[model samples]
Target: MVQADERPASDTDLITLGRRIRHARTARGLTLDQLGERVGSAPSLLSLVENGRREPRLSLLRAIAEAVGVPLNDLLSTEPPSRRAALEIALDRAQRGPLFAALGLPALKPSQKLPIPVLEQLVGMHQELARREEEAIATPEEARRANTELRLERQARDNYFPQFETIAEDLVTRAGHTGGALTHRTVARIAEQLGFTLLHVEDLPRSARTVTDLRNGRIYLPPASTPGGHGLRSLALQAIAHRVLGHERPRSYGEFLRQRVEITYFAAACLVPRTQAVAFLEASKRERDLAVEDFRDAFGVTHEAAAMRLTNLATVHLGIPLHFLRVGDDGALFRGYANDGVPLPQDVTGAIEGQLVCRRWGAREAFARRDKASEYYQYTDTPAGTFWCSTQTGSGDAGAFSITVGVPYAHAKWFRGRDTPVRRASTCPDPSCCSRPSPDAAERWAASAWPSGRMHQQVLAALPRGAFPGVDDAEVYAFLDKHAPEQ
Candidate 1:
């Protein structure tokens, strides 16, 4: 009987190795025989390796990479280097992991004789390479996935962080925000209470709204963020939230996103504390006109801030259920939160983070409104129910984004804009929604007038897969371990 080879090669390893060799060989425009001659191997063997028919040894792979004028790592790694470097990676990970806990021995790489620093450097290099691989893959999709997961987590917590709110309320009370509004005095007091010395630097980075130098306890604000009447009070609140929350480095990407949400929540809570906000809402709810602008005027905050704060009142105090939607200029729903069974557009996984909003909705309509100070009011009827939405569009840092506060028809009578003649029906899931083209458009303008807005995409040679697609599981585990706290 013929004895089968005991050390059989894996299908995955062979396929990955084969693709890498083929790509490198083709890039150099070298024939099979020409490359084989440089590698000191026969053309047939090289061809077999390229075709994934034969598993090449480390020596052969090294020679091939050298012949192709590339490093061994370049040829061996695909989208994920951590998995491709199997044996060395496993041993390297085990050394850092619980496997060698009792041994009290030093960690080792492929060459066990290498010293600790050398091994650490090698592992660090590997980690950097693996991160590069991950970046090369899932640039857009992974970001969207992170957003979707973040939204789900926030929803799980009911979009309200009680702990953060409690802390924010305490801070606000200590700062003496007895009045309903967060005046300049209260804002400055809040900053002083948080131990952050506020400074205004005009020449800060163009993208920088606020910068906190933790060591010196100084919060620098760029004037560009708030060029008009008052400065960025919300920015101050955000920086204060970062400090008072005592938030360390978040472990997972999800946790990092979660912390941002919590920080923002804390900031908003400080800006408009629930105790005062609820009292104001209760007072306003009694009036025939419940205006967000009225709330904005009374609180001395942004229209968007007033709108968002109203969403908190739904579950917290007033018991008026509502939904909030913030859409970009391009009709992308950037921030959306709903607790009143309002159906948000989502994927099969029930993720609404990156979904596009129907152009017919009030959120989209608000963008076209050139009057920056004016609010767009619309009573939209969807499959869910009739929602009365009032949105205010802003320019500058807003980037033409619209902030909307919507309530069900049953609750619309309490709002100010409910009586406005603006009304629209949006059957979002139906094919007819936003499908009809412009009535004034003609066949003559078809070729030249329409903007394609085409963007280039990098063509990946092949999509690679591993236990963790383009990521290192060990690195992720080690990170979570740090944030896990001592058991």
Candidate 2:
């Protein structure tokens, strides 16, 4: 007695195998009935196998191969015998897939009269549908994991990307930026060089910072009077960076996060061209007067962007490993990166986003200062090692946040904030550090307090669905339709 092959095969694999068997039989000038007779099988049953409607037993496959004068391996090959057979197999698999069943569409039967172009078009549509469905269903956990992986990768490289630096330098040269802070006029020149026209629109999509109409060579941005208008140059450059980098629709959450990082780095590099920024940094280091505020002023960027740019250049160019953090007033870690062994709070997934930062760190302590006009500096002793940090407070629509940059105690001597008198010890990743209440306070308030917790909806929700996650496709399309000039 012979058994069917117990190993599971996908519908696609089985379909391809069946097509190969049929092709082999036909090539040998044998009809199904004649082949079935030789293999001791009925013609009708052989027809079912030939059509991919049934799985033939291993012994029967061997007999069929023998009767068709083809090697068993040839019949078992997964490749379709020809292009038409490949298209038929794809269509059949798509029809049997869950997406097709969910749509409740009538299946198209493959016949000699079905045009090859029609088959190609249908298969292409099905492939796109499958890709979009996958993109839509990426859960929050997947997004977190992807972000965590990206952070680790960037951290390993000290957040420095020389290729993006080269691209930015080239673009800046093309824009005629000879040095100093990259101005808005120069940024516009860069866009023009890239074949894009800058169009300030009041009705730009709320979810998007910048929208590029690739078809019409237009980039739409919020007017300069907007709250985030200070960063318009960076935003416009980020939009153009996508086109410059040849970014395609992301197939997974990881790819999206990667593209986001790449574009952000490119934008920052363009804002503070590497050669100029590094020279200024090297001078600051030599003077032992390195400061994020000065960097921000020189580059005409926000404190956060300056801090991030410092991380991008510190270890690679200045020979100093550093860490950067953006913490909310409520102590949540919005963004963090470190190459200097600074201990950052992270979940089991290694994600720092949304995790509550230690109150003892400079990022949180900066918020408590009465004078918000100046940067706050501190020395924090942690389980890993002591670190010196400088933090600056700023507010946006989402309320207050602190941007911080730090280095290990050894490297702190080169920074201006090294003389700060404020010092604190942090035992983070330990509940007692800042997470747990003090014994006296807990005894007094634990039984009396009944305050309702403020919830963050995004924490409990899945990542927004789309080719570019968090973007509304309908809104973007409608905006383009409303703004597109008559063609």
Candidate 3:
């Protein structure tokens, strides 16, 4: 679906579009031909317009409204923000098309004058109804369904794709960066071999770690601001995935995310070659519990990468069912991929990403350590089941982050820290998981808590809530801004 980033500031009036003529006509019990006769348009043509297959001339749309006994604006507006904004875009494009010329509709811009009452109705739709709709899901089950679908897709692969692994291995071998170590020099050589242009900008926006300017064919890398110096190569591979895999504009949010999953998997597989990684893991698992830091140290990758690589090995190589978590210092889960069918925290929209995880999990508790250099492991019992996890702390562009790899307690014997003295029990999804504020708990740590830690951010500059939930528009802005066509 086309993203609604181009919704004009002056076009806020178009938001409500509370009703569709199709809905109004169905309410009136009139057939398409009956309405077409009243509006002097063909039934087939009217159908095309309603389904977004054909654009109705402005005059024809007005006639359709008058025939249906609904205001013209009501016929044009849809309830969803993107749909309503798309109507405006469609109308603008239609006005500039050949059909409008044939119909003799006057040349007009989006700002051109129209009846004030129509304008007022548009404003009402844009302001009131759309705002309410934005905060909620059309169907509560939909959010849950979306998360389920993503989970199913992840399980479908069982966390391994030999096709992508083959591509990664082949690329690295051809670049002569095979065996022993995977370093920044290795990533650089592969990037140059792949003909990627890396540009480190003087004024790189701190808000974004990397930007892809496809227009200029340059990947903008953030400076040494991020602690791990491996971000540039990772970012370049991510950018390369779009072109390498011939990705197209996603028709839906899920499809967009699926593309992202494929890209990250490919990038990770490239950095930690399948043949080498599997061999290294086999040796490590046999020697002792597999330590993720050793994997990270071997491949100069981020802690998050090492965690993901562990899961990547589970299905084909390790025969272990694992779960991965990318938890932020603030307790938000940036990523959750599990093949074990364990219950993970989900946001209001039923997404694991961006959901606030239970504080007792190793991923969250690792952040509380006085000695972060030391590895942490937790044998935690949850309502779903017990999981043994290994967590390590890291600093990234998103601030302090935790990368964790966990397997069901039965499989813990295969991982490092499985026998560690650390342990915790969690009753999350039940209000008792230690999230809610209580008087006794507050008193004990009241002095230590930041008394004035509230950010109190201004909402004036924030982007409007659109179709997707938990999407940060600033990231979208950075991505699109970097990739927008050259003027």
Candidate topping TM-score: 2
Q: After superposition, how far is residue 292 of candidate 3 from its true place, in Å?
A: 0.5
TM-score winner, 2 or 3: 2
Query: What TM-score would each prediction reach against the true structure?
Result: 0.65, 0.74, 0.61
C-alpha lDDT (0 to 100) for residue 60 of candidate 2: 83
Report the Cα lDDT for candidate 2.
0.88
Question: How do the residues 363-445 of candidate 1 rate in per-residue lDDT, one tens digit apiece?
Answer: 99877776778788998888998888888887656467888888888888988878878888888766568755555564557
Instruction: List the candidates ranked by lDDT, beginning with the highest.
Output: 2, 3, 1
Worst 10 residues of 1 by lDDT: 458-467
Q: Positional deviation of 77 in candidate 2, in angstroms? A: 38
> Candidate 3 vs. truth: CA RMSD?
12.8
Show the colliding residue pairs in model 3. Answer: 1-251, 13-122, 15-126, 16-125, 16-126
Q: lDDT tens digits, residues 303-380, model 3?
A: 788888878786678788888888889988877888886678875655675578898899999998988896788988
lDDT of each: 0.69, 0.88, 0.70
Q: Residue by residue across 390-466, what tens digits does model 2's lDDT show?
A: 99999998999999999999999999979999999999989998899999999999999999888977777776676
TM-score for candidate 1, please give it.
Answer: 0.65
